[model samples]
Every structure is written in C-alpha cells, then in structure tokens.
Target: MDADRISKLPDHVIHHILSFLPTIDAVWTSLLSRHWRRMWYYVPTLEFSQFGNKDVEIFYNFVDDCLKHRMMGMHHNTMSVITRFNLNTVYRGRRSKVKLDRWLSFIAQPHLQKLVLNMFEYEPVRRRHYCLPEVVLNLASLTVLKLVFVELEACYPVSLPSLEYLYLGHVQMEDEILHTLLLGCPSLEELYIKDCDKLKSLRVSSSCLQFLDLSGNWETFTIKVEAINLQSFAFSNTAWKKPCSCRFDLASCKKIENLSLHGVSFYPDEDFASFISGLPLLESLALDQCDLIDIRNQHLKFLDVKTVRYKDRDQANWDEEDWDKVDWDEVDWDRIEISIDAPNLDSFKCYTKNLLVRFLMNSPNLSETFIHVGYCAETETRRREREREWIIVLIDVLFLVLLVELLMFPQVFRRNCRSPLPNVNKLKVEMGGYDEDGVRDALLWLAPSAETISIELEPF
Candidate 1:
C-alpha cells in the first residue's frame, strides 16, 4: 500500500492507533496531512513533556496551538475527553510560570479526569510555584488528582463529588487546607501523602476510605485517623518519627480486614494497644521495624512482627560499665500480657524466641507457628554443619574399633561381641578366635545378606 493511501484510514481507525502512542507523538502526527491534522484533537489523552534547553516560549506555543485546534474541532455535545494530562517541565525563570498557567488554563476542560503536574527548577532567587486554577479543581468528573511541587493556598475548597483517589507529593499546604480539600471530596476512597512538608496533622473521618498511605516529613505531628470502612493502611519513611496515637472506632465496618504498620521507630504508647484490641474483625496484622510496647490482638487470624538488626558482630557487645550506669528495674513490664481470642487463628510469627510457647499451646485453633530469634549465638545453618561433622567422626571411629577387636581374636570377637547377628541361615559361622580385622572381614563378607542392618553408636 502507498504511504498516502495508508494514511487515509478512517478517523476511528486512526484514533484507535493513536491511543497507543504518547500524546506528544500523537499531536506531532497532525503535520502529516489534512486528514491527520485534526486526528490528535479527538485523542482521549494528552501529555506535555519539555526536554532539553528548548525555550519555554516554544513549548507553550506548541501546547496552546494544540489545545485551540482540539477545542475548535470538538463538537459541543460530543464531550471530547482528555482522560489524563501529565506535565513534566523544568522552568528556567519567571517567564515559564506564566506560560505554564496559560497552558493549564487552556487544557483545564470539564472532561479532564486525571491530572498530574510536576515541576523542578534550579533557580534559587526566582521562587517558582504553580497554583492550580479553580476551574481544574471544580471538575465533577475528576477521579484521580495528583499535585507535586505546587503550593495550594487557602481558598474556598472546590467540591469534587466524584473524586475517588487523591495524591499529594511534595505539595506545600497547611493541615487545615488539606483537611478542607479532603472534606470536599465526599467519595474519596484512597489518599496518598508523600513528602508533604507542610502537612502536620491529618484529621479524617471518612466512611468510604479503604486504602491510605502517609510517608515522609521529620516534623512531629499527631495523626487522627478514624475510617469506619478502612481495609488497609500503610505508612513508610525514616522521617516519620513522631509518636502517633491512632484511634480506630469504626466498629460498624464488617469488611475491615488487613492492617499493616511499617517504618515506625518510636514505641507506641499504652493507648495504642487498646485501639488495636477494639478491631473486632481484623484478619491480618503486620508490624515491621516498629518499636511496639504492647501488642495483644485476639481477633486477627494471622500476625507477623519483625525487628531490625545490625550486621556487625562487634557492635552487638555491651561493656559492664554501660550496664551499670542504667537502672533496669525502673522499666515497666507489669502492663505486658499475652492474650488473644482468635478462635480461627491459623498462623503466627514473632521475632522474640523467648515468647512463651505456652501461648501457642493454649490457643485452641492455631495450626502453624514461626519463631525467629534475631541473629542467634549460632545460626541453624552452622549448627547443622557441626552435627554432620560429629556424625562422620563417630562412624569412622566405630569402624576402626571393630577392626582392632576382630584382629585380636576373630572367633572370640565374633561370638562374645554379641553384635546381634542377622537371622540368615548361611551366616551360622562358628564363634571362634577372631581379631578385629577378621570380624570386619566377616561382617563385610555377609554384607550381601544384610538387607537391614542396625548399629548402636552410643548408649541411651
């Protein structure tokens, strides 16, 4: 087929093919011909990427022309959708900010559902930031909204009634402003906060929330999470050092299943245990690298807890002077109790080997248990190697001892040795004078009939 004729395929076929390419490549194809000129306008997604030292003006002009062409060709009732609009740009100066805002305004249409904005610049004195316009926020059809390196100021919170997922990465906003934004989205089910420096406190009471992730920030702030229908919660990062007190009071949510706590260093206070005990239907629980003071949950069917370790063996030692300086009696262990009511419990794992096995034996339903003693004095692998070495030495010594006894008195050794001869009719060799070697030879000679042989290396 000729290139000209192949390029004249129907609009539906062209759109289907263009959907696979990136938005930039799709838009560039418009220069092919008049038929292909307006093809990118009907494409369902748009992505703008600025690379190299290309002037910001050129990038803005390209984006502006693309938007105008799309809008002009779009039918009023046909609802042209930009399902995803991703912008990754590096601004050099203040001029780029104006161009960026203009580009956002042009593509900030009602049909845009998912929007991602990322900007990284190295101009210290310029102080660059992007503020999302109100029109982009008020889109009722937007379900996923992600903002990075942007500053969200205090304004009338835009209501996105249909938004179900929201991600804020490196976005500077106060706690109240974040709470207000969350409150506006009544249908939000998943929220992710990553490296949000200004976010201090998160007070949410969403019944529809199922997944949540909060990570980063060295600043200390208490989090108040109360989701009646939450199924999974994960927190990660070394900067999350603040002592947090969580209250899960959603008893009506019968579907609440999985809970995980990760990268938490501080020991949870006594109140945290009380909150965990209240989870009536929790199925699985995982605690990783968290200094937990007390954890007693009877309702969960599975539990896993692990602690961190140092690879250096020398660092594991402690001096007598260091021990004498601290008073260990002041520590509290009175509140510690191992109690659980998991009637359907199946698996349990703990890092503490000292954890009483009586707990597992007492449970009526527990089937499998894994106990990991962190970096033991002797690992299991080393212990097995030692055992194999001892067995080999023992076998060699026994063989030598028999040979010497047979060499001395072959017949006497055979008769008095009482080595429990096999019940073979042909092996009725008279018990006469025999040395260790003779007895060894006789045993070797009868090896063919020794279908099953028994030897006692040591007495009980």
Candidate 2:
C-alpha cells in the first residue's frame, strides 16, 4: 500500500506546510484526505492573486467564499486568527471596492500583523482612485504594511502603534495626511516612498527611523529629515528639476552610517563641503550624477561615485539622435575637480564618463576596487565627427577621466608617488566603451598583487 506520509504528519506541521501554498491551493488540499479538510483552514497566512481577472465578480466571490465565517455564519468569526494577508487584485468598480472593504473588515483581527494590498486600477472605468478604507490604519498589531495605488483617507487620526516598516508606492497621500499618518507610527523603523503624489513638503522627525528611501517624483519638493537613530538613507530624484537647488536637508541625523544621493548637485556656492562635514557618523557614501568638490572624512570605509548613470531615464543604450542634442561648449567638462580624504577607506568604486577627481589620502587597507567607464559610440561622432578612426578617439577618452587614473596609478600620471591601493585583494573593471587590450592592461597596473581580477567589456 502507498504511504500517505504527508497526511500522517501532525496538525501544526501540516498547517505550516500549507501556509506556503496559495490559499486556493491550500483549500484544494482538503479533498486529499478527510482529516486534512479542517487543517487548511487553520493556516496563519492567506495569499490571493487575481492577475487581471476578466471576471472580477468571480474573483470576489472566491475570496468571499474562503473568508466568509465558513459554516459558522456571521457571528462566530474566522476559524483561525490569520496573521498575514496578501491580496494582488484589480479594482474594477464600486462592486470590487465594496468587496475589498468587506474583506478588509473581515480580516481586521487583532492578531493580523502584515498586510499587503497591490491593487491596480483597470484603466477604462477608473473614474477615481481607490480611497483606503479607514479600518486598515487602526490595526494595532500591524507591523509591515505596504499600500500601492491606494489613497489614505483623511477622515480622522489613523493609528498603527506597532507598525515598524511601511512602503507607500504610487499612493495618493496629502501633506497633512502623511504627517498625521507618520505621527501614529511611533515605532516605525524602515520607510520607503516612491512616486507618492501631491507631496510638497515632508518633515520626517521620527526618533525610531533607521532607514528611509525616497525613490522619485521630486519635481518641486522640500524634504527635512531630523531623526536621531537613522542609519541608512537613500534619496533618488532622477528627474533633475534645477541644476543646483538645495531642496533636500538632512537635519544632521548624527548617527547615520550610510548615505546615497542621486540626480542632485551641491557645489561650491551651496556649501556642499560643509554639508559633508556636518555628518560625523557617516561611514559609507554613494554619489550618482552629482557634483562634488571634496570628500573629507576620517571614519569612511566605502565610497562609490558615478557621473552618468542612465541614458534617457535609465535606458541601456543611447542612439545617434540623442548624441547630437548635447551643446558641448556650454558644459565645463574639465573645470570641476573632486578630492577625497578618507584614510580608513576599505573599498572604492568609480563609474564615470569623463571627469577629473583626486584622492588626497592613501588607502593602504583597501581590499576591493571597481571601475566602469561607459556609453560612448564607436563612430567618434562626439570627438571628431569626421575622423572615422578609432585609435585617436580612444586616446582622448583615456586621458580625460581622472577616477581611472587614480585607480590605475600608472607611473606616467604621478612621478614620485606609489599606488594608493597596493593591498587590494580583488579588482573589477568594466569597460562600456570600445575595448582595446591596452585599456584592460592599464587598469591592472595598480593592483599588481591582487588575488583576483575581473574585467568585463560591454563595447558599443
């Protein structure tokens, strides 16, 4: 006789196994054995996904069937106090909203902890965005809440005391609503907001915030973050509004250990040097498509600097038409210089187009180094336009970017000085420009004693 080994397992064990399966699939397992029927109902988590269901009513009915107090009718409540619920569904009309509201109310048990609602509006009938049902924010047991394409209702003061992590993506939230919403999450440790609409000014004064990531949609926005315990913060508004606007202000989050800034420039007049000096606890820093004059830090361990990250909103490759749009005469390509002074730095990475940068101090303890030079055409269209030869173009690009010079540490550039990264254990170099054997050989000169060397070439 075949062994029914899975069904022979204990009730809790079966429930645990079933928790990983989809709610519908878990429910289907009930038919495998008579005893297993009741066990699936006790699983602590439920996940339902209707990937653009053509029949919205059918999906709603399925969820209602599964969550409806079972045979106990309206009075007894769910069989088990579900801890987590994830619903990725399409919002069709009032009926879908009504069903979602009902389900939210049904699952608002005190034991519920994590709630994820990825509701996308069906374009044809999306007359208005879905306003979040107020009951969701009142869950005191909630810890991780992710709301996408949902609007927070400004009905009253919402409270989620136990919330530790929150993600708001494409969420329609007003300034006052956000302030009040954050005020309620006193224990929130990590927060991520991307494409949040209608936000003019954001004041993050949370004492418990340790990590914050503001991804984009900062056309005209001012952010003031004053947190005591924040460690890692990343802000990327790739849609550059003004060349040198001081819209972002970190209220000296003194304990921050890691920082990343993209699509922002704070140069000489803006006093960016003083801004870096203010953060005494910063250990690792990353600057992308940003203008920096100097980086003087004592306790710094890791540094990453990139000039041209994306081509037309992070596109992979650039076409001929886009290349001709640049007015090369206006941009001071060589006037700007970046000098770094971090003695304890361990790892360094530089990805650039063509710019000059300097490292004021030596990195004796450096173990890892990475360099990526990229995205120029083969035609030499920008350099000489008429000269179809590649050798002359390669020479011009090689001599321009200073970060590569600092890494390669060739004898020609510096007369008396030795290589700063002599003890590097691993070296990685990526060339997006036309690859010649000389380019690879040149990058490997500094790290002569490196244990491992990786060279990647993506030639245009």
Q: Which candidate number has the best lDDT?
A: 2
**How big is the positional error of residue 343 in model 1, measured in Å on the Cα after superposition?**
4.7
TM-score of each: 0.66, 0.76
- For candidate 2, write residues 51-159 as lDDT tens digits: 7557767888888888863323224435566889999987766877888888898888898999999888877355356788888999999999999888887887788
Would you list the C-alpha lDDT of every candidate in the order shown? 0.62, 0.72
What tens-digit string does per-residue lDDT give for candidate 1 at 101-213? 77777767777788888876557356465666676777787888888777787786678988999988877789998888888888989998888866666787687888887
Q: Model 2 Cα RMSD, Å?
A: 9.8
Q: Cα lDDT of model 2 overall?
A: 0.72
